[model samples]
Target: MTFISLRNVTTLYSLENVSLDIAEGELIVLLGFTGAGKSTLLNVVAGLTEYQGEVYFNQQNMNGIPTERRDVGYLLQDIYLFPHLNTFDNIAFGLRANSCPADEITEKVEAILALLHIGHLKKRYPKDLSGGEKQRVGLARSLVMEPKILLLDEPLASLDPATARNIRKEFKALHNRLNLTTLYVTHDFTEARELADRIVVIINGELKQSGSAQDIFCQPAPEIQEFIAAAN
Candidate 1:
């Protein structure tokens, strides 16, 4: 059931001895304060950050895999939609880049739009759409590529409170529906509670504790307790 595994992973900027395993189809939330190496850990998984340990995807070595070859999808806080492309074009951008067949690209784009419940907004540009809509478009674009693992780095951080909550709900629903293994990075405990099957708390660049929601929330270790207290 294990789909992703990191062993003795160490990142730059003073993060040392970081690691964890993510189950197949599981949603893992990286919980930590800012600059806790949450984003660096995600990039390590995505092959976007350099690390000294081994990363495995589907039990295969990911040591030499480039970001493109790793088949990991990353969703950032900004969504980063192309300025010139409309919603549909942005969604299909990856497909076009990867040289997916034209008919297949259209079908995939349409399916993702419908799956995300934004089929009607495909014609709109990011400028015209609301924050929630733009985020969905970013997600669908990543999902369309059918990456082996999806990585989210505080995808909900920049939204207004109400929008962030609603979008996280939609994201959790989508995660369940698609059943894709996702590594979600966030500082919000509430969002982590809603999305993660496993909670991994990292502080000062090291893993403090990791387990199910009940275990992490109800019986937090001292480091986790300190983190929660500090956050509140």
Candidate 2:
């Protein structure tokens, strides 16, 4: 089933005439360089940006749905954990805002912490955590919300290579275990190659190509041919 669909999604600023469909439990990677409208497309689905198009979730038009009501868990490259909050509180912030009961909040937070392997760091503050740890905490914060869709924008771009690789494995595992429909944006070819169920290439705010890894690599557009060669 198509879990998310965007039709002629032209953003007010960058993206133009874009359309994509993400199946339930599928992970789609938006592969593009900076200023390529990858993030703008993400913001469009997140309902954070104005666009002239139709965005649908489970066949229901999300035209005027507010961001909070969209049931989307968004994690950006910049992990902003509140300075005053510890790991537990940071992840619990959203639930707290929704006025969830204290006991239920603890249960949900702890489960996500364990799933992300950040259980031990729950008591520690953001300032004391490493880069990878902070990213995991931020991921935990998003996952703890139990969203139906997950949108990640270069979530591990700031990490060291070794750490990024390890977290990439964790991301794959989480996606499989949770089975959430995910749209991830990144410029890292390796990340897209390893993680995407399907890779969609965007250039200058337009979707240039989309297909399986082999399909894309076998018959890439001119720009993407250069991109693949440059990555290699």
Candidate 3:
């Protein structure tokens, strides 16, 4: 069933009238170059920006819902961890903000750390961690919240090729295990092909096409063909 819907969504400057529907437990990848408004679209669903249109989650209108109430786990490209906080504290920040019991926070944080294989890094600060370690820690912070929806904005963009590939595999595995309804934004065709249940192509804020990987590659729209050609 449709779990998330955007109808005639438009931003003040970046996004245009765009509509898309995402099903429960589906991973829809938004593929586009930088400044394509992919991130803005994510912020719209996240309720972090103003827009003109309708956004619904699980059949409920999300127009006026606050960001925290939306139950969204947003992982951005930067993945900045607090300089003074250890991995454990950084991951536990959200739980603490919600006034969760200390023991419960510890339990959740530890579980997430183990899930992300960052348990060993819990005592280390962000300054001591490598790129991949930081990324895992950042991911742990989001997954620990157990949000109903996960929004990723070029999460692996800053990593090296090998690290990006590894993290990509982990993301796919996590999605399958958690059955998360995820909207992943990326410019990488390979990443979209590997992870997306469906791929939606956005160009200059407009959705040009959307379909399975095979459909997109076999009978691409003119815009998609051009994008692919440009990539090649």
Which lDDT tens digits does candidate 1 get at residues 1-232?
Answer: 8899899999768468877888899999999999999999988998887889899998999997999888888987688999789999999999999999999999999999998899999999889988888889999989999987999988888789998988888888888888999989999989988888889999999999999889998999998888888898
Instruction: Please say which candidate is ahead in lDDT: 2 or 3.
Output: 3
> Please, what are the lDDT tens digits per residue for candidate 3 over residues 89-156?
99999999999999999999999988888899999999999998988998898989999999998999
Rank ordering of all candidates by lDDT, starting from the highest: 3, 2, 1
> Residue 149 of candidate 1: its Cα lDDT?
90
- Give Cα distance to truth, residue 4, candidate 2, Å: 0.4
Off by over 4 Å in 3: none
- What TM-score number comes out for model 3? 0.98
**Model 1 poorest ten-residue lDDT run:** 11-20
Q: Is candidate 1 or candidate 3 better by TM-score?
A: 3
Question: CA shift at 117, candidate 3, in angstroms?
Answer: 0.6
Model 3 gets an lDDT of 0.93
Overall local distance difference test of candidate 1: 0.89
Provide TM-scores for the models: 0.96, 0.97, 0.98
How many residue pairs clash per model? Answer: 0, 0, 0
Best model per TM-score? 3
Model 1 misplaced regions, further than 4 Å: none
